[model samples]
Target: MINKKNILLAAVIFPAVMAFGQQYGGMWIPTELNEKEMKAMGMKISAKQIFDPAKPSIKDAVVQFDGGCTAEIISPKGLLLTNHHCGYDNIQSHSTVENDLLANGFWAKNMGEELPNPGVTVDFVLDIKDVTGQILGNTKNLDAKQAEQVIKNNIDVVSKSFKTEPHQKVIIRPMYYGNKYYAYIIETFKDIRMVGAPPSSIGKFGSDTDNWVFPRHTGDFMMFRIYADKNNKPAEYSKDNVPYKPKHFLPVSIKDKKEGDFTFVFGFPGRTTEYLPSIAVEKIRTEIDPAMIDVRDVALKTLDEKMRADQATKIKYASKYASVANYWKKWKGEVEGLTKSDAVGKKQHYEQSLIAKNPEVKTTLDEFNRLYTEQSPYALSRAYYSEVIRNAETLSLANNFYNFANAAESGKMDAKTLENFKNRLTEIYKNYDPELDAKVTAKVLALYANRVQPQFLPSGFEQYKDVNRNLQTIEELSKNSVITGRGTLNGATMYSGIDKVFEDQNSLVQNLKNDPLMKLFTSMRESYLTKTDGKYAEYQKQIDVLQKKYMAQQMETDKNRTFYPDANSTLRVTYGEVKGSNPKDALYYGYQTHLSGVMEKYVPGDYEFDVPKKLIDLYNKKDYGIYKNSTGDVPVNFTATNHTTGGNSGSPALDANGNLIGLNFDRQWEGTMSDINFDPRFSRNIMVDTKYILFIVDKYADAKWLLNEMKIVK
Candidate 1:
């Protein structure tokens, strides 16, 4: 029942150069590389030489912030640099109308004035050592899954034993998911403080309208500082916070990032699932996303209308809008790109060719197609069933009640778990907006009524079918309050929150055992299990086969080349030139951007694109000052084709000599789908120029001591 058209499309989608036989194909050299090996492979230097901590190439350019985001140490006495947006939510949470830091911005003129945000920690990459020989001690007889687990268990065991390493912490991650694993021993800092930040007008200029788009002009940068214990070791904050001295600090410079400069980014990148099946991509592009977009579009429009009409509503949804609109736009673009591009077709062709060459892989693809075919009708319905999440007000209410029940069963979770729970809930509680939640939830349910299959919707919801949820929602929603019956939900005083609803003998938790909501959730859960579970299994199996095949091919072709497994994110390093692109010949995107571009993106009232008057005035006057590039306006924008993914946010973009030059934050919109298809034309990494970050810190923040600490190259 699988669509032949879909399969036909994937078989011939990619160029041979992109799909086959080259580890260093796109700017990444092997990690196992030595000085001689690298030089022979046309690399400028050995991988070890560049990555070595003691080498002049390595600098203390990074500053470990308490925990919110990564920062570079540009000064020996402990100054920190990172993105303002990375720390935006934190500042916004602590800010009040009387002292609205987000609206006006914050600047710590001196250490005494610096503010501390609790539960935040910064990590410094102290050293990286290869433990591959130790991990793969003997994976010869083990199958893929077993081999991966064996390597992982070994790394965890190794990392745990490394606790004795002075001033260090260890993280064991399996790169390429399981093909490779590494134990990273890092130094951590607990004392970090706010230093300087440009006002929203400047830092967040052209907020959303220009996000992920070229010709952008947002400053998008911030600064912080690190404090150490009296012994010069990392320690938690106290009244005795003192500057920690470093073995080396990165010299702050963007003096030489020419268009052809080889740039690399380093940091704890989040994650990327690059090896998704072509069929899966098609499903997202063609089936699921469009429906979800339609549903959200109605809700967003309704919320936009209300927010525009009321100030409280506007404030309530500002974060919500900002949070999702970026992705929504990206998804819209992705669906469009997927439909128009030859990616799916190419993938199918590639898959078919592989099948023709090796029959075993065909079973995996066949099973994958069969699963997707059987699941399509209900796949979306099951997913959209959670349309109830407009506001997780009930979840909190439920969580609180659950906590009470839990307390009765096992005294408050042990201190450690409790702290973890609190930390996890920090953003949830702070960002929850009730009115907006209600609106988002209600509109989604309304979407179910209008767009979902009749059988998929509960009868209670079916009555309002065939109506635009946004426009004709008031009549049906006027009576559909979040809680249907107080007696059923709030049974006891102890059931103070939704959590306790699970505790009471008369609990909604029990009601949910037979409740429609729970039924929907159950049905959806079953569908997913019966749906993607099989596809995922097949996908993983194919990955195993392909990894083995690729490794086999490598074994035959060049045994001397240090082969690294693809970026399983256990660790990855991508190297590339800083070059501009022609998304298509005439419509080119330059590699670098300027402060004026930020001003250009400033629309008067767009939610994500508004520029404050102060920033606009500065730009109009061509007042970038010393921060301007040699061509004149202080270089506000720069680009790199380093193959980056989501987890790379706050990654330090380094130059050929390994000097800190930019903080990789996001990718352009045209390249949001780069995880699937890494088109060189659009997949450029967007970074806040190191110089621009310094300008904001030194000039805007006026944090003089912090400025003096950094060794800025003019």
Candidate 2:
């Protein structure tokens, strides 16, 4: 029996109370904004001013930078701003041992000197239309796969119907776990060039030690420019390409930010599971994350030791090492945060309330609990596969070669596929160290064999269950397998030999089948596909269905409460205020950090905390150059309550008047868990203040011409 009156009362009152209590957690869609809430929170601009499709609005200024991060146009000439880490790969690609731009820094005095980057792109959202009605019509009786097909087919049809210009594309992404959908018309620019970046001492100041921690003074911003054809249309890289004239661009603000100043971030957020059930959270905290964390810990420890021993190895593996360590550290923080917050208990309590309000949904809640329990083992097995087999660089490469050999043996390899595969191998081996990967592979395999259940463990791993034996076995396999490229003549030519081996498909296949490493990978992959992957898929599909139902029910029962769709790598807006964090009883962090703090952390010749000589000289001369705050210190970075995630890197942090005040790069340490559960008390997005960016460009880099191109407001 369900009481409609009580349900209605809870819907209205609970939402209002929650909205009042939780001020800054949700990543809201621009279309379904809560204007009243925005106004109450010191928003000086209207909703239309933030996102208007008919005319240029704040949304037009933000674009997806290099696919994985966000950037904002700062000048009509398409001068783009993003996090230095976001542009790190492009900068590294252009660097060499002789002239390492990442080490010494690079500044383009003029537009002609800007370095062109191949394959870097930016996507601007032209429009976003809700197509749920069109996509979900006539789908009541279809199975999940059939319904999925219908949605995909409909999206294709709808995408084609949109009148888009050349180089423009349409993307339809499902939100709220397929409960709702929106089609985005996007314009992608292919000709992107790097303009300026500070030395690692400044850009990556306090590197790993200060990363994800507050009281930070990192200048983590990078500058680039988007170029278009003569007709101002998107085009591939060409010498003739000119700076793109954007519809709108953000004006940099140098005004000092006080505590509690209104702030908002607009960008493409990657993912968030804030709506997941308690059982799933418990599974992640108890089983999945720990296994992944342990595997990465072993891999990182091995890499770190090798990297410290040799400069060449350090340069080669720096980016890969950082990528692994970043998430490795974050996962640990997430588990700790979840446990400390008692997230499972809170979710269970919330669910109980939901059950009480709607007794009819009690069956659904039980099913959720049961399905999660049943799926935990398979999920853990899959996590092991992801962490060990799939992530080990050499094993992954060997698997790639195995696939290529199969394709050739089956007569399915064409010139295009073969050429693509060869090019991929070239890139893979460029920075790859076979010895390092071999060491990592041994540890990963041993971990999997020891931790995973006997029946769930990948086949053939049982033979090498002993850790020392596993290491010896992999070392021996590394010597035998031509794929590893160890002890091979002209190691440069070794990867190229992949093409020669492909000439004799049957022989290559037989060789790979006999290779110990390949054989091991095959056994593990077979066990995964047969015993783990299939069950995981079935359980995942069922879970997704129930989750969607749960989401729909929540929306229906709480119309008065604003139910924001979970982030699915779509453009979203999250607003809050300039704030600090009190992670512990006595550890309170200030919102703003300054150049003085950078000097305090500086150590001569230190990789992470070194200060540039020119910056030191400027500080000694007290050349604040109009960029310093009233306290006469140049502001380096700050923190805010704006909800952000991985993809939100390089997002523009706007003030109440919609001026670009900071560049969102990282989040506070405790706030890393905000991706799963945003607690305003601790969650704060770290940003590089705009004033610091301008100061570095003008005074430090002496790129006054670059500064002149922007609309800088005091």
Best model per TM-score: 2
lDDT (Cα, tens digit) per residue for candidate 1, span 1-714:
113573355335422222221222232322443334223323354465445566533424454344434566677777666777887866786689899988788887677887887767777665556665677787778877787687767877788777544668787655443445566667777777777677777677767666777755667777667788888887878978698777666777758467757666655444454445577678877887787667667667766887789887677667777666766777776676565555688668756765666676666676667666556666676545443333234333343434533554565556566445545544454545444554555556566666666655444556544444533443333223223222345543211343443344334435544543334434434544565455556655655555445444433444333433444333345555577665553577777887666665666866556766655666677666577787787677677677776555666777655567888777777766666665554667788887777666655555566667767765
**TM-score attained by model 1:** 0.78
Error of 2 at 264 (Å): 0.1
Each candidate: how many clashes? 54, 0
TM-score of every prediction relative to native: 0.78, 0.92
lDDT of 1: 0.60
Model 1, stretches more than 4 Å misplaced?
1-46, 53-69, 129-156, 161-163, 256-258, 339-341, 349-382, 386-443, 449-464, 468-571, 584-586, 601-621
Best by lDDT: 2
Q: Write the per-residue lDDT of candidate 2 for residues 1-714, one digit (tens) a residue.
A: 113684466457555423542432878889877767766667899999888999989898999998999999999999999999999988898899999999889998889999999899999988889998888886779988899888888888888989988798889988888888899989999999999999888999988888888889999988999999999999999999999998899989999999878889999999889888888898889998898998998899888889999889887987788778888888888888788777888888877877778875678878988999999889999998888865588789778977887788788988899889878887888888888888888888888888888888664568766778877878888876767865333232346565565565566667777777787787888888888999999999999999988888777765445778888888999988798767777778889999999899989987788898999999899898899998899999999888889899999999999999999999887768778877777778999999999999999999898778889888
Regions more than 4 Å wrong, model 2: 1-24, 96-98, 238-240, 308-315, 458-460, 487-507
Shift in Å, residue 83, candidate 1: 0.9
